[model samples]
Target chain A: MQKLLDYGPLLLGGAVTTICLAVLSLLLATLLGGWGARAKLLRPRGDPLNKGLIRLQARVATAYTTLARGIPDLVLMLILYFGGQRALNWVTELAGLDTLEFSKFLAGTLAIGLLYGAYLTETFRGAWLAVAKGQGEAAEALGLRGLRAFRLVLFPQFVRHALPGYGNVWQVLVKSTAVVSVIGLEDLVGLANDVGKSQRDPFLFMLVVIVVYLGITSVSGWGFNRLERYYSRGMR
Target chain B: MRFDLVFEHWDLFARGVVTTLELVALSLAVGFCIALPCGLALARGHRSARLIRAYVYVFRGTPLLVQTYLFYYGLGVTLGQYDWVRDSLFWPFLRDAWWIALLVFSLNSGAYATEIIRGAVITIPRGELEAARALGLSDRQVDFLVLIPSALRRALPQYGNEVVFMLHGSVVAGVITIQDIFGVTQTFRARYYVAYEGFLTAAALYMAITFVIVLIFRQLEKRYLAHLGLSR
Candidate 1:
């Protein structure tokens, strides 16, 4: 326990990795979710040439989300850790590259993004649906079609509506980075575990783990509240 | 690429899925039993209720994985002297992976379910209780006849959500080397190095299982809420 602080560099590295992974994944998932919701709402029916395309997209999205949400995050992390490396190895072999690396950091980001993207998709979709129908119709009636209509009316309303739920989802995702630690990602929990193993003081390291998570959650909460207020302006 | 792999391994998969289902079902059932009573007791505002609330908050606030590790590793060190608890005649039964997994999951689920039940209990209409009281019924009798039943019904939808969540959550049992579906799938992946096939199959199976659970809940909701159709 006394020597635990000697590994401060490693602990800082873990925190950086954890925060970066969580933030990047949140950004990517939100963007993907926004696009997915838009496609679901605005896309027209499919033709004989593209039979079942819409249903397929919807099912894929459903499957993505269900799989992500249903399985424990630890299990998801295991699959990504082992499976991602294996797949990358296969690809590298085919390209005749002797050694191409797939960093655990990148794998963690991609896995969390793809998994939580399913959840964000549903949140974004619900938000989109909650946007009042009259606002969109009025935008169209005012000859504000295409990008202008979405920019002036729909997008802002969607963000405002989605912010609260999205904030909750982000909190869940941030906590989920703890799962990546099981796969040997040097996140706070992972570093804590290492520190514990080396010092033989599991409780103290676990406490550090808890404090790190609390710190991250508190900061993100402040950021989320600020965002919520900013988006929620100009409303009664 | 080989369909024969599944045919050859059909028994293993079936056994795994059944074990997984049992794990989920037993935990959910036990958890609900503990949760419903605790929730009711906590809502009663007795002197002991504050302690129960603290228990519920700590359990519900932390992630399930953290709880699982705390029970397994943390307890293993501090409480290792209680070897007879897992031993004796019970050791053969309790030492098994499935049962211990069920125990951890049941406790976790019970904590979450407490909140759901507590919320439902608070929402029971006061008018019905007053009517029962006017009939000269005892307080206990009025509660048994009026309060508990309606509160449980109101709590059903949220309870259904928790059920689905637990069903999915049971996959973590695999982490402790339970031969559940997820564990068996990982073994196949490791053995054959067919990462895609193994995970894709596992993912699809998980999706199918969750879909079925959601479908059953939806039907239950429709049946139970039919009385409120006009309001709906």
Candidate 2:
């Protein structure tokens, strides 16, 4: 009990790092996912001038999502972390520069972001599709075009539709951040393991770790629920 | 680039493949067995529903890696300190990393399977249940003969996803010194000091396995779900 309390600040710091990693990765995933979704949904019907480019875009997006989703997250992380480090060092040495070290935090975030980005692309595409085709047509009928139409008309509806799936993805992504500890990130799980090993009471320390994870998940679940309710207002 | 190194260490890769397959197969089989009854209970709102829900919530909420570490390093170590546990017949199995991997993976997979099954069971049309009841089938008979069969069919696609997910999740076994596929890749990388070849090869292998899983599930769906096909 005294040892746990002594390590309280360290565990709290680890929890903060975990949250930061998750949020940063979520931002990266949402960015990639949005672009992937747009690329996938690009249609030549509306604009014949760029038909060739759109087809290429859609194909590239399809390949990205397929490859990312098929591989396991841990494998991808290892490949990106170690393989990426080697590549970076090779490039730097070739340029007569000092060999660079790849940060575990960055590698973890990027690997997870890229992996979940595939799933999020599907989620976002589904959400966009769920918004009635009539809605987009209606926006165009009202003489709203391009970015304005999407921002003012389609975006809100997209949010309302995407919130549930987004929340689900967020929850899973948060849990996945724990995998970063394998790469020696000083995240909650990593810290707990270290602390527990030194104290020779890993079971008790692990129970505390589990409770902390449960708390994080439960709190976030509640937040997502509230967000969903807010977005879903004025509709059945 | 280091294809020669990978070829030289082919035996390691083969061993890894066998371990990975065994881990996934055993875990999924055991997980499904555990989940089926729990799922049915949850779907039927049985008296044990709350307990099952709590189990699902805990497993789903935590990372599988954390669960793995907790079981192996935490519980396994703690139990080893006990004279009774050390002297028990089960200690041999408990001390083996493979068994611990199997136990943790199965429990994690079971939690996800339970939810998949419960959702599938609930979405079963009310009329189907009514018809089964109308046919002089008792509740147990209806569940086993009608509900379970249809639910399993409906759950096929989702369960296929779970199987792939389990395969992916089983990579954590590598972290625990299980010499699974990913572990083999790590060993190859460390041994040869080569970067891309080993990990990329493992990636290709995993992708191939996933492709096979998807193909098998597609065939299963085509056969069992033919009635729900649009052509009909």
Using lDDT, give the best candidate's number. 2
Residue B39 in candidate 2, Cα distance off native in Å: 0.8
| Model 1: how far residue B162 lies from native, Å | 2.6
Worst 10 residues of 2 chain B by lDDT: B223-232
Clashing pairs in 1: none
TM-score of each: 0.79, 0.95
lDDT of 1 by residue, A1-236 (tens): 45656877787888888889889999978887876666566554668545467667766666566666666555566667667777889998899888667777777787778767877888899998999989988999999998999999999999899998898778767866776766677787777776766776555666666666667777777998998889888885
> Tens digits of per-residue lDDT for model 2 on B1-232?
8799899889999999999999999999999999999999999899999999999999999989889989998657999999999899999988999999999999999999999999999999999999999999998899899999999999998899899889888889999888999999888888889877888888998998988998899889988888866211
Which window of ten consecutive residues has the lowest lDDT sum in model 2 chain A? A42-51
Could you tell me which residue pairs clash in candidate 2?
A: none
Q: Quickly count the clashes in candidate 2.
A: 0
